[model samples]
Target: MTTCATELLDKLASRRAIVAVIGLGYVGLPLIRAVAESGLTAIGIDTDPTKIEMLKAGRNYLKHTGGEWIAPLVEAGRLRPTGDFATLAEADVIVICVPTPLTRHMQPDLSYVEATARSIAPHLAPGRLVVLESTTWPGTTTEVLKPILETSGLSCGRDFFVAFSPERADPGNAEYDATGRIPKVIGGDGAEAREAACAFYGLFVERIVPVENAATAEAVKLFENIFRSVNIALVNELKVVYRAMGIDIWQVIEAAKTKPFGFMPFYPGPGLGGHCIPIDPYYLSWKAKEFDVRSQFVELAGEINSAMPRWVVDRLAEALDRSAGTGLSRAHVLVVGIAYKKNVDDTRESPALRLIELLESRGARTSFHDPWAPVIPPTREHAALGGRRSVPLDPATIADYDAVLIVTDHDNVDWSALAEARLVVDTRNRAEREGLAGPRLVKL
Candidate 1:
């Protein structure tokens, strides 16, 4: 039997193994940069030819990729983002960072991960280490992914190696680099696979926690994101109830965070946004149903977070109804911040998108002002309004709009500019700025 510790040490010392990273998106792109920066040349594989061209031209599509750094790095020959799969046969260490986004029903969509594995399987060889970093259900690595890899008459842990190492990268956090911000959790088929997986991540991560099998590693990522989804939902629920009681949920949370033990705070938002929190929980919920278990917290959190758009719309309607000289039908609402969260440009599954739609449906004319996202695309209720780019932080324009809604609290927004507005709906609790705050603020 292959020993985990021995296998890992051998792979690293051999540095002759070509590093291959599949799926060059938010996660894969950063990882490719890290692998290249680590003094080893890695092959970045992506199906999107445009993305490949962007990489070749030294332009990264992700908002977090910071064109300043990636541009110079790609100028060198350390990384090559290619559309070829034949590179898989040349890899010693292969990390799969494909998307595990939810389907229309919020079910685990493994088509990319599974299909990628099948495609790479034909070229998979002995002594190659395979690690999956995509957020997924618990048994995906050992069950769904392994079957596909073994389809080429190759056995896992025997003929080759397989493991799961859940990626915990916070896309927008400048402090959390791919190499060291968080410790990596690794699990595999057995002791050997576990060690090999640990050794591989040990090269970049601060530390590694090895478990008995790949399922455990997969579960770790799901549980971490699910915790955030539930806590945020809890606050979202509390925000509504507390508003009725005339107590600010944000105030209560800030006070409750003082308890040293058993308490960590997750702020309330318009909805759970981004690729992880909104999608990872559903992976568990979908898998739970297969085993006759109902993940109630996950389901409830999902339902509550998803419904926040409607609630925000209702609140915007109420804001307009209560306004002094205008009706909801004629009110011009300016939503500040459209990205999923503050300081990040990524808007995948952003709650602000839904909120914008809800506002427009009620006859409230809406324009967004996001420093990151210049243009707002149409969703369920909004038409494709051309040139609806983010407006500059001008108090005159703020005064022109009847109401200014704070959907996302990105860093650069000048809250003071909107202080003189006739109405303001503060959803992300971001109206407070160093020189900003006035009587016009309405906490939602």
Candidate 2:
């Protein structure tokens, strides 16, 4: 091993390394806690002062990451949150876990990742290891990140080490914690960088799978989400096809899943949501164009997934016409769960926002109810719907709506109260499973 690689591995073995995590949002915060839990000092660096203040105040801003998880680390002084990049010099290992959202034109936006690299480049020193945990297109670590860090007049794999490790974090999943149980996929520019990174992550992560190079690690992350997007799109297309044939897609999925060995079920919903599934696949599609190749499967998936909100609204309008003897114009529609998926407060890329806009554009009066998100916060894409708050889910309130649309199936909702609605458009198949069935309950 090289001198720099040897030094980092020694520090990791001794649990005396100062691990710095950049971009302390959903990915970084939990990682910091894991680093602290491994008996190393963890410093969380972010440009957002509001998040730093919240961390200092012992308050958790994310619904899935509880303050209790951070409290013990803060009290023990093992974890420190800061808005300063100069502290990068004190860190023996730095992990980048920033957001990689798509641009307005559906292209890859690496601005945040590039800016983070620039911020840390000046403070980077010899014998330190840097690992990127952000999901991005292939060749990002070696192409985009290496050049920036080399600006510090040090050589990677010699003076410093670099690696790419894609994060597999699932928000609001109680079954998975940062206890090293989830397998981590890592790759580096060279053998030394790869060994050093694997050793560092081995401190907290239980299982580490080492690949050939940084691009492979990057591809691993993209492929994982792309698989989900493609399967979801397939099921979504089948949903429309089955609907035209007078078939219920939910019932079809349940029956197909009975094969047990060959079938894994993917359900159709209002649309894709959250930070990963909806946006990460586009990063691959955009990158493929550089090689003069088209990602046709990914493109088709994007087209079908993106069009789901409109299709849902069309079904809803048809349901309204059939049951309530009215059109979408001026119809009172109650939307359940504004967050992307069930049981989480994250609303980024949530289909419910699009569904709401589509409904309102057709002259439907829309109101939403989510136990997690009481008030819709400002988002970059859906600023107009920011100020709206969740409505009460009582029997009397539900009965007032012309139709109730199930967008997200949060577990805490009073499922029985939905039985009182004049018309119910079920997109999640939740109402039927909950014993809500009648001429009024319409499954999309």
Candidate 3:
């Protein structure tokens, strides 16, 4: 190992390393919490002043963070929150947890990652280890981040170190936390960078898996989300076919899962959502085009998942037509659960927004009710839907809508209350799971 790597490794091993985590959103906050909880001094850096102010006041904006847990850490001075990139100069280790979203053309938009890299470049110092926890296509660490940081006259693996450790953050998942419980997959620019990165992560993370290089580590993240996309696409296709054959896709999946060894069950939803499943597969598909290869499977999966909102809307329209003998033009639909998934406030790439848009485009009046998302926040694609508040889920409110459509199956919702509605379209099979069945119910 080089002297820089050796020094970083020593600082990490002795718990003397000043860890700076950038982009203090879902991934960054949890990571910094884990670092501080592990007895390391963690500096939380973000470009968002609101997040900085919230952290400074010991407030938790995210629901999954277990409520104001950062207060004690902030009081103890173990967690320092700031909005300055210049603070990177004081950090022995820096982790970038910025978003890697797609562009309007569905191609990988690395603007956030690029901007973050540029911000860190000027603060680059020898013996400081930089690790990227952002999910992106292969070679981003070497081809994108390393090149940007080297512009500061510091060479990776020699004067400084660089690594890619993809963020596997599952918000609203109470079972596991990514920071200290989940296994971390790390790949470095070189042997020394890899060693230093692994050693640093090994201090907080439970297990560390070092890969061949930065590109391989990047590929691992893409592969994980792509695997989910492909499997979900299979189930989604099966959902359509089985529905045609008068079969319940959820029942088939539940039975197939009984024979544990081979089949891992991937549930069908109205559409794909969340930061990773809806977005990461496209990164690889876009990257494959550069090598003159077409990721037909990945692209096909994207097409199916993307088309799901329309399919659900069509199903709802058909149900409405059958129940009320009137089309969607005169219908006032109540959409249940606007969040991407169950029990989470995150709405990134949520299909429910598209569902609402498609419904309105088809002349149906739409209102939503999500306990988590009381009011829709501004999103890149669904900015027009922002500021819309969640409607009441009471029986009286359910009685008013032409039909109640369950897009997301949040456990907190009173599923039985839908019996009061004249018509109900269930995309998630939530009604069935909740023992709710009647002539008014339609399962898509």
- Of 1 and 2, the candidate ranking higher by TM-score: 2
Model 3: lDDT of residue 20: 97
Task: Report the C-alpha lDDT of model 2 over 35-137, residue by residue, as the tens digit.
Answer: 9888999999988999998888778888777778777788889889999899999999999999898889988899998999999899998899899999999
Candidate 3, position 108, lDDT: 90
Q: What is the C-alpha lDDT profile of model 1 across 1-444, one tens digit per residue?
A: 555345546757665446899998888887777777776668899999999998888787777667666656666867877899997887878999998877776677899998899889999877778889998998888888888988979788777788888877786677875555578788888777777777666666677788878998888888999999998899999999999999988889999999999999988878878888988888888889899999999989989999988988787777677767577778888888888988888777888877777777778888889988887655433345534788786877678888888888887777678666787878877765434455567777
Using all chains and alpha carbons, the TM-scores for the candidates as numbered come to 0.94, 0.98, 0.98
Deviation (Å) of 202 in candidate 2: 0.6
lDDT of 1 at 174: 77
Q: How accurate is candidate 1 locally (lDDT)?
A: 0.80
lDDT of 3 by residue, 149-262 (tens): 999998777899889998887776778855688889999988888888888888888889999999999999999899999999999999999999999898899899999698
Question: Model 3, poorest ten-residue lDDT window?
Answer: 170-179
lDDT of 2 at 408: 95
lDDT of each: 0.80, 0.91, 0.88
Question: Model 3 TM-score?
Answer: 0.98
- Best lDDT goes to which candidate? 2
